[model samples]
Each structure stands twice: as C-alpha cells, then as structure tokens.
Target: MYKIAVIGLGYVGLPLAHAFASKYEVVGFDIAEWRIEELRKGIDRTLELSEAQVNEAIANKMLFTNKLEEISTRQQLNPKKRISDNVYHSYQIFFEYKESYYPNSNKPNNQ
Candidate 1:
C-alpha cells in the first residue's frame, strides 16, 4: 500500500483524499486554519462531506493540520511514509459515459 498526501480540502481534494483513504494511507492538507478547524470537528462547510464521513475519516487516523511545521513533523514521524509520497502527487480520474440523447431535433434539408 502506498502512502498518499492530498493537498487542498476543497471540492476536489476532499473527495480525492477520501477515495484514496479507502485503499492507501492518505493525508489531506490545506492552508486554511478555519478549514482545518472545521474538519477537526467533523464539519465540512462545503457540503462535500457529511458529519459521519468526517468523523470516520478522523477515527481512521486521517490527519488534518493547519501548521506547516506540525505537518512536517508528523510527516517525518509517519511510519507509513504516506505523507512523503503524496507531497507533490496528482490524482486524476477520467470516466467515459455515453449519453443516448441528441440535441437539435431539426433535420437539415440536404435534398
């Protein structure tokens, strides 16, 4: 299992981190102190996460921090080394879905 670090806890980062946490060890990082505080209390102001989800994340050892120094210290001591692997990592997922509907119902008169 690889260690993962997710930066920014906005609409994008939060979900990504949650998905990663399901499999690998994940660290979600953000610079906002208030955001960190909200996360600590199992509240997502963005409505991206329910209180239960946030609490579960916390119970699972997913860390949330505002101080860079503390984050660094914790990273160094992280036996899983998940934070190091995620420092500059990027996670992208592309899903292809086909729609059966078509727009512009008017037919062109080619005749």
Candidate 2:
C-alpha cells in the first residue's frame, strides 16, 4: 500500500487526503494550527466537508497535523506533494477552466 503525505489543508489537501486514505495511508499537513485543531474536532470551516465525512476519514486513519517537523520527517520517509492545479490560479479562472474547455478562459464572460 502506498503511503501519502499532503501539504496544506485548505479545500484541496483535505479532500485529497481523505480520498487517498480510502486506499492508502495518508497524513495531511497544514501550517495553520487552528485548521488542524478544527480538523481534529471534525469541523471543516471551509464547508467543503461535513462533520460526519471528516469523522469517517479520521476513523479510516486519515490524520491532520500542524507540525512542520513531523511533515519533514514524513517527506523524508515518502517524498510526495499533492496540490491542486487550480491552486496556481485565481478562483474565477480556475472555475472557468473547470467548467469549459475554451482556451481563453480569461476572457470576460460577457464577451
């Protein structure tokens, strides 16, 4: 079974870690202490995941931590990064590209 480590736990990492945990061992790393605390308590302030969903993921061994040292250790043990392609762009552009196949997603919607 593949071991996975996800960095950053915003909308992207949380879900990705959860999905990976269904098949592989997964650890989610985030710099934000509050975010990790919330996740540990089965709360997702981003509203992407319900409490039950988070709890289920946790039950399956999907874990969240705010320790950079732990993340570095995991990285040395298993080198990998799981960031969303959309994270590189603004939400508007990301959503546009996600919805349509047009090459020029940057064009004004009115055009």
Candidate 3:
C-alpha cells in the first residue's frame, strides 16, 4: 500500500488527499496550525470539501497534520519506496529538493 502525502490541504490538496484516502494511506500536510485543527474537527474553511466529506476522510483514517515529523515517519515506514513521489501539491507549496526525506522529490515549477 502506498502512503501519499498531500502538502498544502487548501482547495487543491484537500480534495486530492480525500480522494486518495479512499485507496491509499494519506497524510494531509499544511503549515497552518489552525487549518489543521479545523480539518481535524471535520471543518473545511476553504469549502473545497464539505464537512461531511472532511469527516469521511477522517473516518477513512487519513492523517491531517502541520508537522513535518509526522510525514517524515511515513517516509520511514515505507523506506523502500519514495513517499515523496506520491506527494501532491498546489502551486503555493514549494519543496527544497535537498531535503533528506524528499531526496527523490521534484519541486513544482510554476514557471
């Protein structure tokens, strides 16, 4: 089973993460603590997903977090595979490719 990390959890990432959660172990990562809290409570402030949809994702065992450590642990659990390769993101997020956990990761180019 692939573990996917969707980095952003805004309009794009949240929906994608929820869709993926149906088939994969998904971690929805965002930098805002409040956003994380809201999602955990089954709230979608961005309105991209309904509260029902948000709660469904939660019920599916999707992990929503702002901590890099949580996603990092998923990488370790699937060490043989590149968890970063499964990462989905919106244009707002950028990755420093040099980051150890994302060695094989590609930083999205908005250009």
TM-score of each: 0.59, 0.62, 0.66
List, residue by residue over 4-107, the lDDT tens digit for candidate 1: 76878889899887777776676787766678887999998888889988888877778876444444454455587656434423211111111124322222
Task: Point out the worst 10-residue segment of candidate 2 by lDDT.
Answer: 78-87
Better of 1 and 2 by TM-score: 2
lDDT tens string, model 2, 1-111?
226889888789888888887888788987566688889999988888889989988999887886544544433442345333234335447557665875544333444
Give the runs in model 3 whose Cα sits over 4 Å from its true position: 74-111
Better of 1 and 3 by TM-score: 3
What pairs collide in candidate 1? 3-82
lDDT of 3 at 22: 93
Model 1's C-alpha root-mean-square deviation from the true structure amounts to 14.0
lDDT of 3 by residue, 1-111 (tens): 327989998899999999999988899988767789889999887899999999999989999988776776454665777555445342125554344565444322321
Quick one: how many clashes does candidate 2 have? 0
**If both were scored by lDDT, which would come out higher, candidate 1 or candidate 2?**
2
Weakest ten-residue segment in model 1 by summed lDDT:
91-100
Model 2 root-mean-square deviation? 10.4
